[model samples]
Target chain A: MKSILRLSVNGKPREDAVADNTLLIDYLRDALGLTGTKQGCDGGECGACTVLVDSRPRLACSTLAHSVAGSEIETIEGLSHAGNLSRLQRAFHEHLGTQCGFCTPGMIMAAEALLRSNPHPQRAQIKAALAGNLCRCTGYVKIIESVAAASATTELSA
Target chain B: MAALSDFRLLRPASAAEAVRLRGEYPASRFIAGGTDLLPNMRRGLVTADAVIDLGRIAELSELRVVDDRLHIGAGVTLATLAADPVARARLPALAQAAAAVAGPTHRAAATLGGNLCLDTRCMYYNQSEPWRDAIDNCMKIAGDTCRVATKSPRCWAAFSGDVAPALLVLGAEVQILGPQGMRNLPLSEFYRDDGMAWLSLAPGELLLSVRVPLADGWLSAYEKLQIRGAIDFPLTGVAVALRRTGDLIGELRIACTGVSSRPELIGGLDALAGKTLDDAALSGIDRQIRRGTQPMETTVISVAYRRRATPVLAKRLAKRLWAASA
Candidate 1:
């Protein structure tokens, strides 16, 4: 039950033969070698496998590859351009947002979605947007700071 | 990670086509958002020889208002439903309930039909396959005994969906399509008390849309007690809709979830229709809810806690809604 899936990933169009039951996470990690989307909880409980499906944050582990055949998917690997870290990525790195870095990719991806729609979100808005994602290291103070710092920087478009 | 078993995926373009496919593949399961069904499939709680993806059916994604009733297609995502200005303004309780589902990401993909038809859950039944195997499985899955109440003949899994109680209070009606044809039924009649067969859908049946009547001048609210502020199912969820007339109770409806196998409407409230929502009426409503709820050991939380908390939450919602109407 494999089908040829035509989708746009990281702004590049991809057409690959994926199994009918292949999860989006596996399709990104195993098929395309996009390991930036981590699978912390195999199920949807943990937000570690989050990716943007058509500019909205979605759980990759719960989505089937074929279900999003024509969707525009953005992963953590798509953030950098011309070897320069995206503003959110730079903020996370400078503010020590990554202690173990397990949840950073998903966190940043979720944050990227939030910042796109709302450039100047409040602290409560950031917390609500990332509520689905879980981070065990740094107690989330640095993560919040990282997103806030990214929001304050007016040089680049989210 | 639990691997999902192999199954043929069928995508249908219309509701009629989806129903035809269901008739074609009797063992097929309809999947809308895959938020609830996919996880259950991974846990080995459900199996399907073929999965009918209803996400592509355009007819089932319509959300419109006609003749003072909001017609919400079954495939409408929770996020869309929550953000709809009409839904937010007309049925604030339902919008609040939809917004309060799992989280931002889950609500993005989770649909109204999936939430309405959510599987009943129990602490023992929702575990991993191997974990359930260690306990020899419960009646809801494989074995004959109901772990929550071993002596009982039926499963005691609690209906944990947050949207059902809100819809029940709104007096919603569901449009169902089956081999026989389309028929409408009150949302309250759509559920049964049995956890294993909670929904009243016949074979080859599909929920098409939900029609909610626009209740004018009625203030409503939904409240729930969850272990976490987000990403947790309600231990006890209560929804109240009330209209006030000259500082007296005009109309009142209360419904609750997470305490029984079905999201139930709290009865015996007609007596309080004209009575002002004073402290005495609130206490009376609280006692009625406490007496109506029959929680079992379906969740990690104790039955006593749910029993006590269900009434408190209902009373609080009633008080809040009543005050807001003033």
Candidate 2:
């Protein structure tokens, strides 16, 4: 069975016929070619498939595409506006957050959702927000530093 | 990636419509959040010819206080519940338990109803089809003998949900809607000890909401032990809710999950009623909890570790509560 899915992905309107069993991750990566949203573990255990549904971080691998119709989805691919990297993305690059680069998209996406809601988050809040996104490399110190740095810069600019 | 079997998705807008769809598709399973159910289906642990999506039912996501009871809609996501000021103020244990669930992203999609109805998990039962096929499968999926205990005839898949134990301790009641009509039962009655048939709901019944009684003079705490800080199911989860009148205990409830086939309220705590929480009294209650709970070798951590740690955790929680009261 196929269902018509209407969603705003990365601020662009997308209407597609998705299978009944198609996961949000599969829809983003395979169907729409939004490969920036990585799929790791495929179960909800790892947040490698993290995406913003209605501006809240959700695991794409576990969410059914049909369930999230008419919602705005922000992904790692959408983080950059024009030719500029997002503040969080820049902080990640500056702090050496990406080691293997597999968990970067998800970590950044989760952090994006965090900073969207709480712009000036503390270090512990950043850790709690990125707790779902796991990075096997860097031992999470650099990733935490990256999110902290981004929050600090955002705090300063505001 | 494991492919889900071919199935028709049914999105029902209301509880009545959901019930009707469930009746029409008796073999179909309800999908909310799809965190636990979808993964199980992917692993071939569960399959359905039709999936009744409960996400579209807006009423199931309501969270409010009505008639002095906190009515938490079944579809209210774990993340929302954890961050809700009312939930933290009143049912703090439940809020903490919701936060203690698998990470931030899973909590965003995983609903309270989904967690309460989470599938009983066994290390042997949660593997991929090929992985289970290699082991000849366990009693939870296909094979007869219990993999946790070879001679046991029953499935020993442990109940790993973090929220159920907290709700059970809080004297919460579940509002269920079915073809027969709406009925409410204590959350304690909602669970069965059997792993395969863990929930006590009827075939077409859907959990609509959970009603948690106002914790007027009560202090509650929930502590979970897992291998990692995140993304892992609790090896042992302990939830305690109690009220004290000066030095004497008024009412007490101690509950635990990830220890047995079902999250259970440790009985005989009524024995501690009208008594002060001395070390001897606590040790006695701790011994009772340790004796009553039966942690099986069905999860990631060793059963020995879980068994030994349950009472220690309970005692520690009780001490913290006492300290707070003081």
lDDT of each: 0.91, 0.90
Best by TM-score: 1
Go through the candidates in order and give each one's DockQ. Answer: 0.82, 0.84
TM-score on alpha carbons, each prediction? 0.98, 0.98
Predicted model with the maximum lDDT:
1
Residues B116-206 of candidate 1 have per-residue lDDT tens digits of: 9999999999899889999999999989999989999888898989998999989999999999999999999999999899999998999
State iRMS for model 2: 0.9
TM-score between model 2 and native: 0.98
- List residue ranges in candidate 1 displaced over 4 A: A155-158
| lDDT comparing candidate 1 with the true structure | 0.91
| Candidate 2 collision pairs | none
Off by over 4 Å in 2: A155-158
